[model samples]
Target: MPSENQGFSVWGFIKGFGKLLIGFLLLLQGIIGLVVMLLIVGVIVSVSDNLAGGKAARVDVPKGAALLLNPQGVLVEQAEEVDPFEKALEEAYGVDEPDQVEARDIIRAIRKAKTDERVAGLVLDLGGLYAPASSASKLHDIAAAIEDFKTSEKPVIAVGDYYSQEQYLIASRADEILMHGFGNVVLYGYGSYEAYIKSLLEKLKVTSHIFRVGTFKSAVEPFMRDDMSPEAKEANLAYLSVLWREYAASVEKARALPQGSVQRYADEMPPLLEQANGDFAKLAQRYGLVDDLKSRPQQLAYLKEKFGADKDGKSFKHVALSRYLKAVGEAEPDGEAPNIALVTAAGVIVDGEAPAGVAAGGDTIAKLLKKAHDDENVKAVVFRVDSPGGSAFASEIIRERLLELKEAGKPVVVSMGSLAASGGYWISSPADEIWAAPTTITGSIGIFGLLTTFENTAAEIGVYVDGVGTSRLSPLIATGVGPLPEVAAELIQQSVEEGYERFLRVVSEGRGLERDYIDSIGQGRVWIGETAQGLKLVDKLGDLDAAVAAAAERAGLEEYDVVEMVEKLTPFQRIFGGAAARAMKLAGLDFAEARAHQSALRKLFAQIKGEIELLDSFNDPSGLYARCLSCELR
Candidate 1:
């Protein structure tokens, strides 16, 4: 039935068959390569994770086990609480989750280990502890707990390849501090820096309209100016000096290295290195900053001799931080409980609710406070505040809610974290007692508002517009409006001054300081926790738990539960957010891997980009803001 031409085309038929065969072979090979790559990625990641975590559930601590206190990754107020399945998937796939250890968890673990008979001492492995200077003092409490152990002569050994300034604070408390032969003891004293975008804005012909009350309010500097203002420089220097002094004093006392050893070492690090022929290990020993220089195995040998080796004699028996936490369990208060509510106002103060990383939004925190207030079993509220400050109205809203808690007969105690400046200080004004760490950065009592218009930018691109309005200040603000209308600028400026006055009054009444005195120390000035306490901006120097204890005492409760008033992740976000992208990236299929990473980065950047969308955002239907832009220190 074939046509005559089709029957005669034998060579053409052979060529078609060969091409089909080649296409099929290529498709098969690609499928095989993909499967193999996936299998390899899975096997490697699964084995590593399973080996690390598969046995964690059943891990048992043997007798005389020392707690290995090595904190890796980021330390935050609270970690995102994930379900078991999500957590397992994350660990297995090596998904990027910022390693977070709660201060309470650390304290509780140390306290439990101190009491547990099987626990002998602590190994201060804080090499990976990335924390801000304000948090340095918070960790001091854990070191204090170790001191309790030291009274019993339990040897606390500190070991690390290198010690950052923050890590050295905790390390200084150890009985014996060891470093690697090549490791350096670095102490670049704390200083803050900012990026000026004014020139760029000018280049793009975008105009910024700024309103601020305090001379020391440097938040608007980046937009309007290139460098730090003289007043800002003076204020920043004063607080940074105070913080440095505190740091030096602590290290000097703990190391018994004389009055000014820490300062001297900092001032003459180059000379000291030269003297030791650039041998940092030698310099550390010569300066008494460290007791010895040893490699990992050598340090292991030292521990083995002191604590007695494990059954295999490979190393000393020790309980990891995670293992010890599980073995000893979280600190549950004794007796019938559920009385104290510990609410955290950690993160940048926003106008509305946000997830874990972003911290307290005004609405979210208000709801949380109300939630605590409504609970009949909740007797006292401990507000643990750590913020660089955001919305002025939002901070006031939070403070008003705290006032409500007081009106409802519930005592509200405030514990300041690393940063509680501007709006941070505003919200804490009404607290029954405000406790801050010696290293806590607080008190940037100021108000500022920023707006941008791009009329000039549009003009540069050959666009022009003229508009008519019913009122002189109609559409007071807009993206294409050049040099914000005079009437609108005056209004914003007036609001900022009033907001500042209100802030002054709040601090004046709540802190029991004179209006003039508060003003003298305020004007957007930051203070070290120690200096703040001296200035009467803080009641006492203590940790979050201490604040909780004060709250419990004020409520007259001998035995109470400390419930966390923190954000809870949604079910969908928990199951599919972090773990799914993590799984695909770990699979190494190269399928949208870049996109997967972009998703994670987007989560972090999206929050920041959305932050400055509108000056009205700071105005928030209220007026200007009391945000502390300089409160954050990198």
Candidate 2:
């Protein structure tokens, strides 16, 4: 074993040194962490005061600078709650997730920039924009604002390397759209696709027990079958077609093309591209979808010619949307003005508390409503819902709070976002008025329960779970490890049926419709906004602003300020957390693992993993869900 030929054992020396260094670093990290915690507690109060009065951190607007409309994140009704320390750590290691930009923030910026003398023009740098098919309403809202901005007689130019379907929707509103010479403009209409895991579960010797009501309630189909059921397909296609029609119509109207031009462009792409000798840019121009094609440098030169140059003369004089918002600051309400509290109930409905932009925790939303109920200044509430639904129990919890708010004599208006189905509809039922966009997906009024057991898999590995108990429900105790008993399964099915009846009753009472009629139209069917209005599911077809105005009108407030009600952070969390994270990074405590950028294959796998993870996150106490899995648009 002795290496006589290996004179210095260089490899062994390096290995030994690496181990020693790692051990030392681990020891040092623990000591440093302890000290940092103590130091944070000591500086909490002073840091809070400084942060409260800090004007140095604010960004300033340059005189006559163009407001660069460059949003770099997913457009959300409300941003998720982020821990500053965790965010800093992610940034320190360069693995932070994309930022969440609020739709309201973008609208506010556009509205403010419309009249601001310092803002001379608008630039659409939307190469990083990623709006989902479900966000058609929000996209239209932003595009409408851009149209309104044009009335101020300031130039609006959209320059990008390429434009995605959603990105092009906003770019179409600009006075000029410049794309890269080699860029392509493709438009893929709406679709709903999901992984079917029934065969995979069978191969793994796993059993999936699904309980559901409604012929169109296909949320559990991925476990029950390898393909979408006819009813599910019919319902999904109906809504998807509506959304696509709306999308094509909007783009056509904005670009001033014929009514069916956008549809023809998408439909005739192959032959059109062949005619253009495979030049996507030329084909786009030929079809009148874009203005001109230029490279990045040429685009920059063109912008500089329009808006003049910056002090350095490298590019145009403009302030990014993020920085521009910072300079403008948030608008505060006038003293004693009646307030219309806008509360966003986004994400899946879940029990207890949850971070913003995550699951819509029943308790968290209820707490927000409770605050609105307690505040005399808040005359009405505009509840924005963008969810595909989740836990039935959690939905009821939120619905009860809305009822309380209504009982308190405050008008509650529900503004449906991209999707407000199943449990999303449940919470909306209690509102005095429900507003939805023409493309909004809603009315999945159904309930389902699922339980996957590993009994067969355990048996395959020579393991078994068996026990004796006091009653027939004894086998249910080990349901995860043993076979589910017939008696227990029957009881669970009965519970699901009861839940469906309760959902029907809730809708009937909320909408002032007969229970029989509600169930006739219900049966877990999904409907688009326009169709839903005809079906009496929604009162009006409109956007969030319309809903806000309706809430004000109901409250009889001639002059009122719209206020976004959000969670407040503690003094310590707001200041010390970020500081501590930065300090730790500087101290060489680099514990974050480096994640490589995702490839196409990796993204596919991630989608599959997300579906499984979503199933795992179902934590309803009743084991019942009012979710619409088929509601997602592609």
Candidate 3:
């Protein structure tokens, strides 16, 4: 016989234990059911979507009139149909991945537009489009193809509300440029804006110990100084100058404007607009910047009247890029003949193999270069580079391999994309020639590294560290531990100086500039293509098509097939790699599951783990590297 209080306690414990067990079992069953339902739904949705309407809709374009839409953002290598579940997950997570427009798709659209008998004219809508340089390079190629259409006596119309200097450069090649009735054009030019973190950290009572080698290595300056270093400033100016020259020249040739006229037109705009009574459209017409000033509806009406209306009253037979591409056959490699390899070096520079949606890995690119070099049928190589630079060693490895390709008798031409700066420029330096767009961001000849210390933070938190080491630099060598020793700092500075010297040497040798002359502009600097040409960093001011033409001329080929150097995944890779990707997505799902399964205790632990994983991934690199930490637009 138990007392009443003891009986009550025993009963409560039993009830609570039973409730937890039952809840656990119910939760497990619910998860199982949910997973099965999700799988079934996913399979059904995938099948239905694939089978809907039998196949993709196709559209036909008329000859001599082409519809051009500058679909710019992130470039997707392949555009796969979106899964409903993935879309839902993305929406729930507030993750808006950039929509991808494939290069091949754009090329196909241009080819179709050029051949279509109904397409008597083309319209380029250049508004709200900010693409990577590599993407712009491809766009420029497509524009050139459109120019070929113009040779057939068809006109290309370019329309923009407000034009950045680069946008104007692209539009300059159009047969007619159209500006809005109230739009303003501002060509303020280009400059580098690096974030300085030293002062920011100082305010937080945090210190950073920087270690790097490269005279132009300004990457670490943000951590140590409030402004750009002297070495960085010098290198940046020369590189930017070279970029600007390239840009201006490209625009000049494309627009058929005389020397200094582009600048003159830009400078005269304020007064020109004022003279037109503030009517931008009238002003543009007066300056020959535009042929017509019309509203969207008016333009559409004009187009309809010119090309005839569809049954729905829509002007002309306008085809979307995807449909047009489907109508035009994909470019296939000619197995019996030699091919010109177009290798794209886009995205961030990282060590090892790159995952999807990031810049390629050095090892991966090296392998591709080696393969292209080995292929005797690959008569010429066009390196399409659109990058902001990355690891110093990786850049050198790529540059060295490219030099080897050139040595092997392959005419290697570099086509600068939206960005070709720092390491990007380094790799391009060894090319036989470099082609850049007027607005292309190029030539950031700088380097940097950062190591943050948490000694003060630990002390403030009442934490202390005790360690024994054989060398004075041992403890300081680790990150977030303490300040670097003086000896270590000196060694790092010397290493940076040596790297800067080597950087200048490479540029000097490659660009035909003397060491002293190169050094004069060798500090870490940034430039647009127009500025770079003035400094002679770029050999030619043109787009990717121009680069291909140059390569063909160098290779002495009157007709050569353009073949992209893309790695074809093996069947095993398709199965295992896809499964791996699926697993990752599932892991993310599992994280959500764990949160839902347990109480706040489990959620906190999971979140901490996730943060650690992210940090670990960021720190997983080999050798010295300089990367823009905040720029992850794609």
Q: lDDT by residue for model 1 over 1-634, one digit each (tens)? A: 4776787688689999999999999978866775575456556655665566533345577799788998776666665464555456555545555566776677777778777788888888898778866565566666677777777767789999989888888889899999999998888787878788889999999988888877788989999888888888888888888778888888888899899888888888999899999898899888999999999899899888877888898878898888777776545556367579988887778787666554568988898999999999899999988887888878878888998999999999999887788888898988999999887889999888877888898888887657677987865644345447788888888988898999999999887889999999888888888889988999999888789999999999987888877666534334444444544544555434334435758666545654654332453556467777676665
* Candidate 3, 1-634: lDDT as tens digits: 4698899999999999999999999978866766676566656655654665324455555443456556655454333333445555556555544466665566566666666676666667767455442344454555567667677666677777766665665677787776767775555444556768777887776877666544565656767888877766665565454444555666667766678755666668777668889876676566655667767776667666655665576555455455566566566756876778988777666666664345656777888888899998899999988766677777787888898998899989999876777777888888888898775667656555555677777677776666777887776655465655677777666665676677778888888889888766545556557667887888878876789999999999987888887665432333334443444555575456534435557557666865574344343243345443212212
lDDT of each: 0.79, 0.87, 0.66
Which lDDT value does model 2 have at 210?
87
TM-score per candidate:
0.82, 0.91, 0.73
Top-scoring candidate (lDDT):
2
Error of 1 at 28 (Å): 26
TM-score for candidate 3: 0.73
Q: After superposing candidate 1, which stretches have Cα over 4 Å from the reference?
A: 1-59, 82-97, 309-315, 333-338, 475-483, 512-516, 567-573, 576-623
lDDT of 1 at 360: 69
Q: 1-634, model 2: which lDDT tens digit per residue? A: 3675474587788899999999999978976886677477547754765776633257877788899999998888788765665676677667646778888789999999999998999999888778878778788889889999999999999999899998998999998989998998998787888789999999998999888899999888989889988988999899989988988988888888988888888888889889999999998887888899988999999988888899899978999998888788887778578999998889888888887887899899999999999999999999999998898998998999899999999999999998899999999998999999888889999899888899999999999997799998887889888988989889889999999999999999999999988888788999999999999999998888899999999999999999888886654555454565556665566543224323436566556767686866598998999998788665
